[model samples]
Each structure stands twice: as C-alpha cells, then as structure tokens.
Target chain A: MNVLNPHLKFQSQSVAKPYFVFALMLFVGQIIFGLIMGLQYVVGDFLFPLIPFNVARMVHTNLLIVWLLFGFMGAAYYLIPEEADRELHSPKLALILFWVFAAAGVLTILGYLLVPYAGLAAMTGNELLPTMGREFLEQPTITKVGIVVVALGFLYNIGMTMLKGRKTAISMVMMTGLIGLAVFFLFSFYNPENLARDKYYWWWVVHLWVEGVWELIMGSMLAFVLIKITGVDREVIEKWLYVIIAMALITGIIGTGHHFFWIGAPGVWLWLGSIFSALEPLPFFAMVLFAFNMVNRRRRQHPNRAAALWAMGTTVTAFLGAGVWGFLHTLAPVNYYTHGSQLTAAHGHLAFYGAYAMIVMTMISYAMPRLRALGEAPDARAQTIEVWGFWLMTISMLLITLFLTAAGVVQVWLQRIPEDGAALSFMLTMDQLRVFFWLRLFAGVGFAIGLVCYLVSFMQRGRVPAAVEAPAAVA
Target chain B: MSETFTKGMARNIYFGGGVFFFLVFLALTYHTETTFAARTNEAEMTEAVTRGKLVWEQNNCIGCHTLLGEGAYFAPELGNVFHRRGGEEAFKPFLHAWMKAQPLGVPGRRSMPQFNLSEQEVDDLAAFLSWTAKIDTNDWPPNKEG
Candidate 1:
C-alpha cells in the first residue's frame, strides 16, 4: 500500500529501546536509595549523620519521583510508537531530554544535602531565609521554578509526539495521567502560611498524585504493555483500560477524604472520606480480572522469560496488597486512629512501591530485554530465580507493612488517656516504637536482597533465537 | 420478563452499586449524629462544650489533641472523654488536676505544658469533653485507656 513511504520501513519498537535501557538504570538508583532510607530508620546515624532527617526524607522522596518519572517517560516513549503506529517526533530531542533531566536530578539532590529546605531557597530567593528552623520543609522559590521548567520540557516532547501521532485508548489514558503529574506538582513549590491550608493544598500534590493520577498511569501502562507481550485482542484490553480509568477517577477524586480525616477538616470528612475511598478497590479488582483473563485467553505460548512473568505478577500483588489494604484504613473511623502512624507507612510502602513502582519496573523489564534483542535470548533458569525474587520482595514488604500497622494501633491505644485519667509520657511511648522499626528494617533487608537477586538476573540475558516472535497485531 | 430482566439486571448491577453505597453513607452519617447524642442527653450541656471548644482552639489542641480520631495522635483520643475519665463530674476535676500538675518528670516522652486554666474554664472544657464522648462514634477508640 505504501510503496514509497520511507517511514514505513522502520519498526515501531525501534524508537522504544533506548527508553527501556534508561529506565533500567534508574530502577537501580531507586532501590539503592530505598535501602539506605530503610536502614537509617533502624540505625540513627547511618549515611552521613550530618544530614538531618528531613533532608534524608527529601532525598528519599525526590529520588523516588525522579526514577519513577524516568520509568514513566521511558514507558510512554516506548509504548506510544508501538500502539499509535507512528515514529517519535525527534530522537535527538528525546536524548537531550535525558541529559537535561539527569542534570536536574543530580543538582536537586546535591541542593537537598546542602540545605535544610531540600534546596528550595537556593533555587528561590527567600528574603527572610530561614536556613533550617525545622518548622516546615521549606525550599527556595528557584528550586520550585526549576522543577516546573523540567516538567514543561519533558511534557512538551511527549505532548508533541502524542499530538502529531495517532491516539489509542492507552495513549489517551497515559496522556491524561502525565498531564496530572505536571498539574499537581505546582503546589509543591511554595510554603502555605496557614498550616492547615498548607496541608490541605499539599495533599493536592502528594495524595492526589499517589492515590489518584498515578494509578491511571499505572493501570493504563500495565494493560498496554501486557497486551503487546501477550497476544490479547485490542478490544479486550481497551475495555479493561476504560474500566480502570473509570474506577481511578471515581475512587481518586473522592478518595482524598482519607487524608482529610485527621487534618481537623470536619467530622463530616470521615464519612465522606471512608465511603468514597472504599471504592478505590474497584479499579484494581478490574485489573486483576484483566491480567488473569488475558493470560488465560492467550492463544500462543507467552515469551516466559523472568521479566515477563515477574512483571505481570507485580500487577496482581500490587492490586491486592496496595488497593485492598489501602481501603481498610480509608474509613475516617479507622484512619482517625491510623493516621500518621506506622499503619499509614504500611499502606504507603505497598501502595507506593508495590502498586506504583512495580508497574514502572514491570514495563522496564518487559521492554528492556526485547530492546536489546542482540540475539540474546534470556536464560530460562535465570528468569525463574528473578521471578521468585519479585514475589519474595513483594511478600516481605507487605509483611513488614502489616506489622508496622499493628504496632501503630497499639501505640494509639496505649498512649491515649481517658479524659479523666493520667496520660502516658511521649518518651515512654517512643521507647516501645523502637522494636517495630527494627522489624521493618529486617523485612526491608529481605526485600532489598530480592531486589538485588532480580537485578543480577537481568545481567544474564543470552541471545534471542531467529524464531523469536513479534507482536501478532501491529495495531 | 426475561428481556426485562436482562435490561434490569445490567442497570441494577451498575446503578444499584452506586445507590446502595450512597444510602449506606447517609445511614451512617445519620446514625452517628443522632442515635448516641439522643441517648446520652449530653447535648444539653452546651455551655461546657462551648468552653471546651474555646480551650481546644485557644491552645491549638488540634495541633496535639485528636477529636473523633482526627488531628494529631500526640495526645490521647478525647472523643470518648466522658466515659474515659469516669463521667461528666470527673471530667472537670480531672482537667483541673492535670493542668495544675505540669512538666511531669517523664524521660523520653514530650511533656505537657501547664495552661493554668481557671476553674470555670476547666468546667467548660470538661463539658466539651463530655459532649464529644457522648457522640456515637460507633464504638471508636476501642479501648478506654486511650
């Protein structure tokens, strides 16, 4: 049909390979930072005792955002060309984007270590310049401006690709989710004068990103990739994607209630928060349906390398552990007790890493091997161990989270006194909290080992045989 | 009837879930606001609650104290104040007593400051405490100790 179309000669996947490679490198960075943060909880003065807790937290949070963003950017770059039947507008721009992003990420981290406010003031000119009062996590205006510019450049490249290219359900959902990341991040730039207002707006960035938009990015990307790897019909995947999007918006918009439960908003907030937040499970449940159903209906043998199986499995565990457990505490009544405790951390870890981070890793794992198609078929035995590693890490993390939640409940009950009773001193309560943190540290180590083994397995890719198959349907 | 059932089934499965959940939200909200407040007769003690509300705000208690399990867990749950400290009578005296005894020599834990509240303020704060405890939280704060 296209006798002279020069673009038709190239494969859709050719553009995506570089994105996959970059994501894998970022994944390594993310896990190492996570291990350090987990260990610091157990031993107070680990990794530069000079760095304050807030600075460590800033590094931890910022690293997660960067790596996850890299993963998402790579996945979109890789997937859009595959699903949309078009080429990226410019490879040179994409490479330039990588260099700029890398520079920004490094500078931001260094800025964080040097300053008390996560390098916000150096970026912005704060006249009063409270270097480190520790009242709130403050940053300079320039740092905020810098982050905004970084987001704009990345979004512009992706946006132009999507605009000039065709739109599929997957791309549309991804575009919406990515736009959300840019929109919500604006709130992170400034300190709110009113603490209550500050918290109220802060969740607009943190809670909304995690519970709301991130799920959209996660669900769409997972479904799109699974569809490509497994030979699922486009119709079926599209239907599943729609259901997830519907569920995310329903649960996500109202799910902001869970955060409001303890921020002294209103008694009404608890009921509103719990009921809507309860529905957060619906989309995730749909995801489990999508995965098992797709795998079940596969007409051909799946390319069962370790990355394929483990990446797919990440979807299932994330839905159950992060979505369901998260719902348990969504109720204001329960959150009334659980907020700000290890219980909250328990949900955050699984929901953040398991649901959000796992999806990113799943994409990278699936795409990376194929991109490197240097006749290196991944070894079956190595793949098996890596798949096992995924389960081990996920299960260990979930166990640690649940244990911390139980500890938090105990802390709330024991520390509180009857209105007419003697109160427990704060010091006494913290003494009891040490053991749980230690337990979390142990589980974290287990999860970290699983991560290490999985990484090691990635290094063992052999050669793809000539008979290795391509995706069945191009569209 | 089968065709009707087919159409009805699809409609109900989707819309029904929404309707059912919405009704549950309403029922829970009503039950919380109405049932226990009526039984406790604690609503009549408005003055004490007003005083307590003032105290809670003036001291930025939400900065530390949690009501209905909301706010900081820094202090104990005050949602069940009346039952926790014995009764309404014990509530005021208890506040007066705790306030007078400040800077308890507890090691490690944060110390509560002495607010030096007047006797009337103490009574009002206690009444507010009682009022909050009487609200039907559906058995929240599972233990009386906290």
Candidate 2:
C-alpha cells in the first residue's frame, strides 16, 4: 500500500497547502532582510546607495506583515473547515485569492526595491490617492485596493462555509477577527494633510489590529491547537478563549491611548493611557496560565510533542515580550524618554514573534502533518529537531531583546535624560551602542539558523511513523 | 469552576466590554480632533508649510528620521530639528546646506543620500519643520539634540 497518500478529513483543506508553503518562503525572505538591516546597524554603509537603511527596514517590516497575513489566511482556511465540519464552500475562490494576494504583495515589494520611492509614488497615482510613505501602510494605493478585494473574497468563502455548516465559538471568533482585519485596513486610505490628525487615526488600523482583533485570531488558533493536542473538551477551551480575548480588548482598546500621549494628543491621555495600559499585561499573563492549565488537564498524551511545545512556548514569550516589556515603558513618564528608541523595537520584535508569529507556526505545526498526510505527527526525530528549532529561535530572540534594551537604556541615559548643556547628540549616542548592535546581529543570525532547522525538519522522515500505525493496530 | 464558567458568559463579556471600551475610545478621539487646531499649531499651517509636508512625504524623510517621536528611529528626531539647528532666520539656510551634502561617505559613518531638492523645496521643508517644532508636545525631547 502507498504511504504519503492524502488522508485529509475535508477535501477543501488542501487549499491551505499552497498558502502555508508560500508563507514559509516569505518568512525566510523576511528574515534575510531583517539580517540585512541588522548588519546595517553596525556597518553603516554596508549597502548605502543601493539598498538604504530605510528601504531595507521597510522591506523587513513589510515582509513580516505580509508573511504573517499569509500565515493567518492559511490558518483560517484550515481551521474554518474543520470547525464547521464541512468542506470549504469554494476552494477555487480560496486558491484564486491566494494567488492574487501573493502577486500583489510581491509586486509591491519589487516596486519598493526597483523604483525610487518618489518615482514609484508618481507612477502609481499616489498624487490622486496619497497613501504612500506611511510606515507599514506603504503599499501603493492599487495594492491596498487589491488587498481589500482579496480580503472580501476570503471572508465570503469562509462565511458561506460557516453559513451552511456548524457554528462553533471558535469559528465565530475567528470570523469576527478576520472581518475586523479587513474593516480596519480601510483606515490606511484615510491619510490627512494634518500630521497630528494623520497619526491619531493611523492607530485605528495599526493598534486596533494587533492589540484588539488580532488577539481574537491568535486566541482562537491557540484554542484550536490546544483542543487537538490535549484531547480536552471543546467547551472548556472555547470558554478560556472568550475570557482571554475579552481581557485583551478590554485593556487593549483603551490602551491605544499610550501611543497618543506624546503624539500631540491631549494630556489627559497621560492619565488614561497609563492606567489602561498598565493593565494590558493581564491578558498575556492569563494566556500563560491558560496554556499551562490546558496542558495540565490534558486527558491524553499527544503524539505531536513539537506542536505542544510550540503552543506552550507561545504563551510564555508573549507574556514576557508583549506583556512585561510593554509594561516597562507604557507609562507616560517612562515613555517620554523611551518612545521611538530601540526599546520599542525590542518589544515589537518579541511581541510579534511570541503572539502572532509563533501562533501561526503553532497552527502550521499542528495542521501541516495532517494536511500532508504525514500521520498524526512526523517521525520522532523530526519532532526532536523541531523542539530544538523552537528553543534556538526563542532564546536568541530573548537575547536580542535584552541587548536592545541595554542599548536603549544607555542611549536614554546619555541622550534624553541629561540637562540641555550635557546631553549627547543622537549619532554620538548611537556610536556608544555599537557593541549592543553587534550582539543583536549575532542573535539574529542564531534566529535565522533556527528557521533553517525548522525548514529542515520538514524534509526528514524515515519509514511510516509509529503514530500513523497506532490507530490501525487499535482498529 | 468549569461548570460555572460557561462560554456564554465569556462571550457576553467579550461583546459587551469590546463595545463599551470602543465607544469610550471614540469619545476621546473626538475630543482630541476638536483640539487639534490649538494643540498642533494649525493657525501657523501656511501654504508653504503644506507644501513642506508634501516635500517631507515625497522624499520619505520619515523613513529614516522620526517626526513628533514617531516613524523609524534610524536617524535623529526631526520634530525639533528646526529648533535644534537654528530657529527662524538661520534654520532655512542650515537645511539648504544640509540637503546638498550627499552621502558624507566617511567610510564607516552612516550616510544620508543626496535628494537634489530645489531651493524652494528646501525652504518649504524648513517651513514644515518649523511648524512641526511649534506643536505643543508637552515639552518633549528634554534637550535640544532631537
């Protein structure tokens, strides 16, 4: 009998395969550009004229966003069908949207690289729409419209499936999150001439997505994976999911004020932002507890040990990165010195990795084996390698954050905290922090090695795995 | 705890709390927008200042430098650059010289690419920076080296 045959529960779940593959490819690209930027920090003129720091940074950040979106789309495609207990409404539509999104994303990144940003703007009719040059929203106006279209198609495909099939809380929450993502993106088109007003509304898209709705996506995905690995009751997981996301929004929605404190907003945000954001870590703390609690209560030992490890790892890092590091500078008094510093960069890298990136990887870990018909899990050695990959990436990321935090502390001390006559200039402060930058670059290389190991684990499979044979023997 | 803590209650809290806090956020936004004219030096926003903002965006200055403590932190904060360099009469000339100096190619030092901006564009950027420097940031940047 042939092994490696597709044993998918739903025929349409295969539509997610291309998405997952494309996402990982883009993830590798994201890391490459990240390493490039990290090098530029130490070797200032490494690629000065050809690929400037701004361009490299833009590519680094934008690729991170796009790949994560790909990951999210893949997770939804896989999770929705299983949750609904039905085949996808239209796998063809899903595949088409995937191509459209992938093409637009690649073309936009090419445009950024090949053309001067100003030339790209003029060629793309940015004068008419004027939506370029904003951080993370720098996609040309046409690409933004394309993203909206792809989002609509995706939502419709997901919606129709759910409409005709089961309606579980996991599906409902994920759907709401996906819809919110599409809705909030419309704010990217609303750039104003007034800079303050421009920034005030920009958070509608950025803050609301990550802190507000993306938590819903992350939570639902985690709950789904926990349910599978723990053999826990769906009701129990779903309940915790709701409570976690509830806390995320309750604190996060108001916590948006923290960005407002120094950005020409009123001083009242000083009070409001501080109080609300101080409580922001509670949800992340709850996540750590919830993950451990679910594992402790698991009825069966999951064969996919790597997937379980990823799920547990996601919670601890998200708490430390997003929750703890975030709390360190969220206060207006502290942020006054630290805003726009490497401290923000540290928090950003860790939080995105822990909360979003790792969850997507967790989903991939859980779903890919079944999607590929590799049995309930890959071989034992593959799981061992993946566990190693997880630790390497996570520890190096923590080290990167710590190095940057040290750099930020020193920068603030020398630059921001001094009296007018005594303060060092920005460039001088940067010069003093070269050692930390070198350390961060090394940690980044470690992260890239971890990613390679992760990719390698996919290629390593010996005979038909024991997990695949266990169920047959039971039958 | 499992029996008493139902999904329905959790769901209710999610919806109810989400809407309630979102409404509060909108109210704060409304208050902030209404005060922008006073708070952000809107009265000083001349035609040149508007063109200066366009110049800023066209060049992607915010790509490397921060304005009002937002944007990439690769370069110095430019929100108060007008005040830091030289205010009023001398700031414009300082900016003109600064823009002309291309990629100070000092081997290992960070380099700024040459944008080849015109005299008018440079002056307009000066106007914009000057206007931005006047925004009531509640005494930010602590010192002049922003």
Candidate 3:
C-alpha cells in the first residue's frame, strides 16, 4: 500500500492538532453522560439527587454541541490554511479563542450542575435578557454573548487567512457556512413574550444550523477529502460540492416548515414542511452517489484506509439517518403520531453521529496521522483499530435507532392512537416501553465500548505504513 | 466526458439559493407571526400569564417536560396538561399535590423535585400551562392523555 505524500508543507496544519485533541476529550465526556441518561430512562433514578436526570441530560446535550463546535473550529483551522495555501493569519489568536470558548463552555456547564436553575439564572444575569431554558440554546444570556464574540473572532481569523492567499472553492464554501452559523445564532437572542413566535424563530437557530448552512460545511469538507484521497480533479469535486449544497439549501430552508406543522404556526406549514423536507434527502443521496463514484474512479488510493472508511460511512449513514429516516416521519400526518416520540430520538442520534460527528472524525482520521507521522501515514495496526472502532460505534448506533423506532411505533399506537374510548396514560405507555429502553441501553454500552477503542486507536504506535495507490480506472 | 458544472455556477447557486430560500423562510415566518395572534388569542395573556411563563423558564421545566412536543422527552408532555387533566379546576389541585410530593421516595420510579412553589406561583404556573394548552397546536398529543 505504498503511496505518495500530499506535497504540501505541514507547519500551518499543525495548528489544528490541539483543538482536535480537546474535541475528542469532550466527545468522551458526551458519551459518558449519554450512558448516564440512558440508564436513568430505565432505572428511573440512577444518580438521583446528585446528578438528576435533568442535569445529566443537559450535560449530555450541551457536551455534544460544544464538542461538535470544537470539531468544526478545528477543521477550519486545519483546512482553511491549506486551501488558502498560506499559514494561518494568527495561530496565537486561534489558540486564545479556543481557550476562551472552552472556558465559557465549561463555566456554563458548571452553572447548570452546581447551582439551582433559578438561582443560576439570576447569578448569570439571565433575567436582564432571559435566554436560558430553551432546548439546545440553554446558555445564559452572557454566555450567549460570549459565543457571539468567539464566533466573530473565529470568522475574522478564518476570513483574514483566506483573504491573504488563494481562495479555493472549499474555503469559500466553508466560510459561507461558518458565517451563516454565526448569523443564525443571533436568533437565540430574540425571546419575545409570544411563545409561538419564540419557537418559530428558535427553529431558525436549530433547523437552519443543522439543515441549512451546516450542509455547506459538511459538503465542502467531504469534497476536500474526496479530492485528496481519490485523486479526483479538484474541479470535479468542487462543482459537486456546490451542486450538493444548492440542493441542500433549496429543500432545507422550506424544509424547516416540517417543524412548524404542530407548533401552532400557520396551517400551510403542514403542506410546505412535508413537501420540502421530503426533498431534503436528495442532497444526501447525491453525496452517496458522488462518494462511491469518486472512489470507484480513484486515480490513487490514499494510504489512510480509516479516512476512506469514515468518508463512505458518513455518506451512507447520513442518507439513512438524516435523509431516509427523517423523511419517514417528516410529513404532517406521520409526525402527528411520532412527534416528540422516540422516533425523533432515533433520527437525532443517527443523524448527528452520521452527518456531523463522523465527518469531523473523518477529517481527524485523515489529518491526525499526517500530523503524528510528520507527513506520513498512520501505522497499519492503528488504522485497523480505528476501522474496528468505526464499525462497533456505527453498528451499535444503527441498533439503537432501530430499537427506538420500534418503541416509538408501539408507544404511538397505545398512547396516541385511540382504542374504543380511551388511550393509555403516559406512565402506562412508558411501562410498556421498558423493553425497548433496555435494548437501547444495551446498544449504548456497545457504543461506549467502541468509543474507548477509538481513543485507544489513537495511542497505538507502530511501524508506519506506506500509502496505498488504487488501480487506475479502466478506460 | 468533461465536467459540465463549474465552480462559478456552484458558488452562485450557493449564494443565490441560500438567499432565495431564506427569503421564503422569512415570508413564512411573517405569516406565522401575523396569524399567530388569532391562533393563540394572545390578548388573553395577562400579567399573571407573563409571570407564569417566567416561572416555567426559571424552573427549567422544559428540561424535564416538553411543551408542544419540543423539549426533552424525560417527562410527560406538558403542552396539553391543562386539557388532559380536565381544565383549570382539576389541573390546579393535581399540579399542587404533585409538587408537594417531591422525590416521592419511591425507588425505581421517576420523581419530580418540589420547587416549593407558592400558592400564587402555582396558580400562575397553571395559568401559563392552561394558556399553552389553548394555543392552536392543531390538536397535538393526539389524545387528552398527553
């Protein structure tokens, strides 16, 4: 599997190493808290007063958001410089902003755990501009302000680095995504007295982030990887990135209507949401076709087998998770039965893991070895362990989604669907769900084990492997 | 075959398409905002309702209970609790009693901590929820047992 090096200089890329390390550490923390939450779902009070379900759940969800942001930031720091063909504008600023964002994130999480919710709200000046307690965006108003500051600083750094050097399509697209992320976040500051309006704009932050600009980021990252690993023409890959993201925004923007169906918004949302979101999977499907086609047509096989595996895994699973499964319950009629059920949970776990988490890890997989080996590939044993980790986590996640989907169906029938003159009480329906919850918990343990393997894989040191060059495509 | 798509076209589409759809989202948002007034009958939102909404946020109730099926799924959906419990009369007492029985000391069963809410605070919280129950959620929860 001997292969050629990328030929690019390496010092600028080394800046991304610390952020990746931090994100991986936070990834571990997220999984630990996730396992805790999974147990509480069944045990009713696993940690009880000490780390109540709410606190644990907050930690779990917040850690996920924080770590993904870390990944994105790391990816930008790593790739933007190379795409621009220059060193970062300021590595010192990147490091400083990293600590600032990380510190704010930690303090906010501690606030959630250490003080009572009400007391914490007061202590953090939340009442001055109340923005706490919403899902996902539960940071205090000051914390939210800090996020904006960090984001602005980040965008400035990336923007300046790209400005001084050649601006490739990858950098441009990634910049657009990062800028959109910052802009959409402003909606979190708007919490009017109107709950309907609050929820409406709240989707601007949540839905738009995942479905809208984030797709641009994901597409560009995938494109960069494809170009490097497959030796595909940069022109071929960049054009595809553009087309894929265009499809994404087209369907994804109106696709936000899907969330509006039952949220007391206009009746038209039922129609709009269903129609647009149904098309949301198109871009993801295109991504799959593009990846496999590129691999099949590879001019050279990259030495990083783990990176290739992750890239393909991300494509296939994202389609199934965010695309197919999302479409399954996206329409108003089906959502009526499945909204807020375990079905949504099922989609969430897979979609985030497949789309965002895996892509970030994909970048890490491809880039980390280069960093460790000083521009050479990781050892075969290390790559094998990572490949193993990928399967264990991915398969367990699939099983978890299946169990949750099954639970959602049964719960909907018994609790939401009526029979004769009655529906089951929430508790009674939950009682029936214990079996599925238990299964999900088991799957979760498998996922945790996989995560440990992934972490250990990084530490393995051995003979570095020569790169693998793929057979040329037959004319 | 040569590539049919160009980076210029893709970049244009990215910017143009992003703006076009975001405009659509904004238009829909405008429609939702204007029509929401009639849907929610928000004129009924008194100071007490405002206070109740504050209480709901202060307590982080959404962390445990979902309102309008949007929050954590840890507890029963609180969006329709008012209607499910048979309106304000039946709901108030049940909510009060539920709050009083904190951590029910029942092992292997989920417990709700006592917020030690005042009587007025309880009334206001109930008011907020009842108001939420009245929102035009298109008959969500699919049944009164939400």
lDDT of each: 0.62, 0.89, 0.86
Q: Considering DockQ, which of the candidate structures 1 and 3 is the better prediction for this target?
A: 3
Question: Candidate 1 recovers what fraction of true contacts?
Answer: 0.03
Q: Using TM-score as the measure, name the better of candidate 1 and candidate 3.
A: 3
Q: Which stretches of candidate 1 lie over 4 Å from their true place?
A: A1-30, A45-48, A118-123, A126-140, A375-377, A416-423, A462-475, B1-146
Model 2 ranges with Cα > 4 A deviation: A1-6, A461-475
- lDDT score, candidate 3, position B7: 73
Candidate 2: docking tier = medium
**Local accuracy of candidate 3 as per-residue lDDT tens digits, B94-121:** 8888788887978888767667789998
Q: Which candidate is the best by DockQ?
A: 2
lDDT of model 2 at residue A120?
85
lDDT tens digits by residue: candidate 1, A41-108: 55544644355334555555556677787778888777766666677766667677677777766776
The DockQ scores of all candidates, in the order shown, are 0.06, 0.77, 0.69
What local lDDT does model 3 show for residue A463? Answer: 31
**CA lDDT, candidate 1, residue B144:** 61
Better of 1 and 2 by DockQ: 2
Candidate 2: tens digits of C-alpha lDDT, residues A363-383: 988888887777788888788
How are the candidates ranked when ordered by TM-score, highest leading? 2, 3, 1
Task: Rate residue A230 of model 3 by lDDT.
Answer: 95
**Maximum-TM-score candidate:** 2
